[model samples]
Target chain A: MRRFHISRLIMLVAVVAACSKKPPPAPPPAPAPAPTVNQDSIDAARRAAEAAATRAREAAAAAAAAAAAEASRMEAARADARRKLDAAVYFDYDMDEIRADQAATLDAKVPVLNANADIRLRISGHTDERGSDEYNIALGQRRAAAVRRYLVARGVSEARMEVESFGEQRPAMQGMDESAWSRNRRAEFTLTAGGNPIRVP
Target chain B: MIAGSFTRGQPRGLDDGRAVAVRSYSAALTSFWLVCVLWGLRPSVLPAQDPVASGVRIGLTYDRSGKPGVALTPVVGANADSVRLILGRDLDFSDRLTVIAPDSGDAPVGGLNYVLYARMNAVAVVQAAVTPSGGLHVSVHDVAGKRVISVIDVPLPEPALSPDWRHAVHVVSDSIELAVLGQRGISSSRVMFVRGNEIWSVDADGEGLRVVPGTVDGLSPAWSAAGNMIAYNTLPGAGGPSKIVVRDVLTGRSWSTRAAATNMNPAFSPDGGQLVFAAGTDGFDLYSVAPFTSDEPKRLTARKGSLNSSPTFSPDGRKIAYTSGILGHPEVYIVDADGSNADLLTSSGFGDQLYRSNPSWSPDGRLVAFQSRINGKFQLFTISVRDKSARQLTSEGENEDPSWAADGRHLVFVSTRTGTKQLWVMDMESSRARQLTHGGKVQNPAWSPRLDFSRQY
Candidate 1:
């Protein structure tokens, strides 16, 4: 009986010693939810940085190509081709009707449009910095509508044409003169996907 | 005469109401006079004209600032002096209270010679004092009755009720104006207009000019009747097609129509309940939408093959006036709010029976103000609703986009008379037009209802 009692005391002392040592170092911390939000933001930031770098490279390449073209004599030819490829169909002052002369200009767009069916053509109308913007917008709409009607009359599908009116907002030139005013009153042909904006000023 | 001048981008023809620069060959000599003021040299203010001897006029008198014995507080005396100038200017601008130039002289001990002032057509007199506690104490006296009308003591704050003491004093001036004239004054209300790509606002006192947002191809900024919000159209870029964006002028909160393909020229209803704008997928037509929230707009006008735009609500909210290009050219048309009884307002009126657009109904609902294309110029004209008779308001320059103040006696319109297309305010009764803004082709000046300052932000 005395031997049993001593054994019990020894067991209690061992249990106390084990309990007093330390708690099992907290079940290795659960994967935090906080890092997930940070990860998404970090990924977005990295993508944005990568996109900025890509744009910088593209701009640099364009600058180099422009420099090379300037060194050569073919830059004018490139400009001329671009001008023809994206020609602007103009209208009379305060008039939206396509003049007899303007008809051929719009007709010339048919072949270019037919060649690239995938290219979306945006016909943006503008007006001289005159009158009220409300009236100008209406005039611009009529101008753009006349162009669209002409374009649709030709081989180009109406679905390919998207019309917008800047109504003296986007001016081709700036000044308080006839030269500036005339240039400002125009409808620009922008090839949204395939080509550059064809503007004549 | 220039060959190919009409080719490609140059749409050069005869000037058909699109002349940004004034073509007035006749030049007028601008005679300048050094204006002496009782206080601050308010540049925009013309020397206040003494009231005509026929009507009940009011004389404005101010407290002296540079008196030898009078001591001011820590605040500069200039601040106190500015308050007096603003009060006098506000009273004069109201036109209901025709005030002569203010003086520092107090009323004579014989009670300001009430009979003599009455004989001189002075029915009321106003006197203002700057208290030691940065307060403005204003007193209005009845000339004939020999009694005090009201004494207003505004305990001004360090920053004042608004951004300036001018706005704070305007509150008192308007109160006096209301008491004297029985008509509320819009002296403290703000006017918003489109300047270039951005929307800008200026207080009626010609102070506290600030730019509001939705600047990415913003156009046709219309002030809501609530006065705290401005609804404008933003041209499509990457955020999708043209959307009607409602911007709170005080708070930076914004609401927009979801993926609206064609929404332009947003005009709020008189109650600020429904928003009417020109929306077109196939062709233009007016549509009414819920304002300051996300809701689909119900089509208001559907004339099938015709184009309708620029819808403005009548002051009563019972009728709507809009510009409809139904007759091949835009003309002013009036219709019910539910889109019926479409009556023509402008057509075969005044000059050439040409284009008329941007119709703004007067607050009195008696006349509709619109811009008519007359003699190769878009001029402002008002048509009486009774007889459909059109009277020309402006003929000298390209004046367009007429908007009326709450008083229905003043108008703000776009003009190129002073070089660029700037906003000009004209007192319709007095025929006195003043340039409101100076630079950057400003257009579409929409005046708000008297602002509720408690809700301003």
Candidate 2:
């Protein structure tokens, strides 16, 4: 393909040089070259041009496919990041402090939130079914507030977060045992606005 | 007349029945003169055992150690059977009277048989006959005096077993209690509670259970002092903030807080002019707003990093009791209505079992009832406001959210004693508990003040 382009360039230059020069009187017809040789040169040049065009088309198609694949991969990454961001952080009974085990779960969300400045979230706090509903609401609020504070301290904008409490009203699990209670006491995150594709950090 | 010991340090009378009867008649005449003299003077100057004060001048008296015995004669006329049953239950539940069911032979013939009633140790006999005007002609006879002491004509609304009819029967029972026990009963009041995300109201006698119209997805329901309005918290939708909703239960008019934050634990002021609740982001703080208007709410507490909730007003509306997490654990606290004089009301640091919430001020302002976490379960407790002494009221199972009845001697609370969360009414004076609701998880019971059915809200 390179040789074909080079020969074509040389022919283009020769034609330009000829055109620029003063046109010579129509040259007398030289002795006729072999008709078979001239046909063979013309066919060889046509074949080279077709081959180069095919190679360029193939290269463009490959590049387009690569771009689509890259876009799809980015989209998948964003979705995964969103899921992690939406993941809830559990709390101990009657507690609002972020548990050590939940640190990594919350830290994973920080980068995603920092990268997506337009994203707004609502952090709702919940509690187990043991305490008074009204008090549980307050506890839930503290949990949500604690989460908001944790994120804000980690460079996430506080204005992008809104905190609320469900108390024990919206339990994630239903049971009288610790298995259900441990899961119920949590802070859940929801994307309230600006849910655009996010870049995973 | 049966000679009985008196609360007052009076001389012992003869044990012979006939001799004591003659002596009692003479003493009764003397007590009548004493009562007239005492009536001319201030009640404070009168002795505690004054005949008038002790219901003796009215010919009915009971020993302090025992509840007065009252017999319910069969009700006559329309819906007699239902009225009799309701009245009998009300009187029995009063805790001030030991109601006796009259036997077939004990039925009155045109007039009450006071002699037979006296022989049966009945202090009072209640007779009810339906009038032609669709009303109950109730008569209370003092068996000892063999005379009718009180007669109340209670208008019974049409339709037997209806809420209105039941309420009227309750009123008659309260009247009977007043005629006999010198104090009205609490049967006429109603209790509002949360039943599966809906607000429901039931009479004090556990009848007339019905959901309040238009109150769905509500929590922490509270009745206003006038028994006309109710304040409760509504669950928030996705990404929305919980809101406090106050509704006029009779007219169905509702008002909601305008703030976009978590608002909960609504309590109406004693005057029903203001609604106080906990509203905030992160940690809740107490706020008060005019419940009937859309005006901006006034902040009552601004303690950052602490949650303040479950507010209840004192009977006089001067002070508010609520739960606060300022000490790193929830504890009952009291503050003036104007947001001043914040003080810890519950004793804390009891070996780290510091959780106490849902403070319900007694109608008498003598105590505040709250739930405390003990041994990994919640139990009902009442702390004296004056002495700060605490008394545990429940131990069987988890109990929480206690609201006092109008009489101040009873409370309605949620308990898991039956293995299912249900509403239970407890007579605080007698330490007697009766399950008011069954077969469903119900909570946050708020007992209403004495409801006046004749008054339009």
TM values, all candidates = 0.72, 0.80
Per-residue lDDT, model 2, residue B23, is 12
| Pairs of residues at least 3 apart in sequence or in different chains that clash in candidate 2 | none
User: Which residue segments of model 1 deviate by more than 4 Å?
Assistant: A1-81, A153-157, A175-182, A195-201, B1-78, B107-121, B155-157, B160-164, B213-216, B454-457
Error at B194, model 1, angstroms:
1.9
Question: What's the lDDT for residue B389 in model 2?
Answer: 87
What value of lDDT does candidate 1 attain over all alpha carbons? 0.67
Candidate 1 chain B weakest lDDT stretch, 10 residues: B66-75
Question: lDDT for every model?
Answer: 0.67, 0.79
Q: Write the per-residue lDDT of candidate 2 for residues B263-316, one digit (tens) a residue.
A: 888999998999999888867789989977746999999897688999999999
Judged by DockQ cut-offs, the docking class of candidate 1 is incorrect
Native contacts recovered by model 1: 0.15
DockQ (CA atoms), all models:
0.15, 0.52
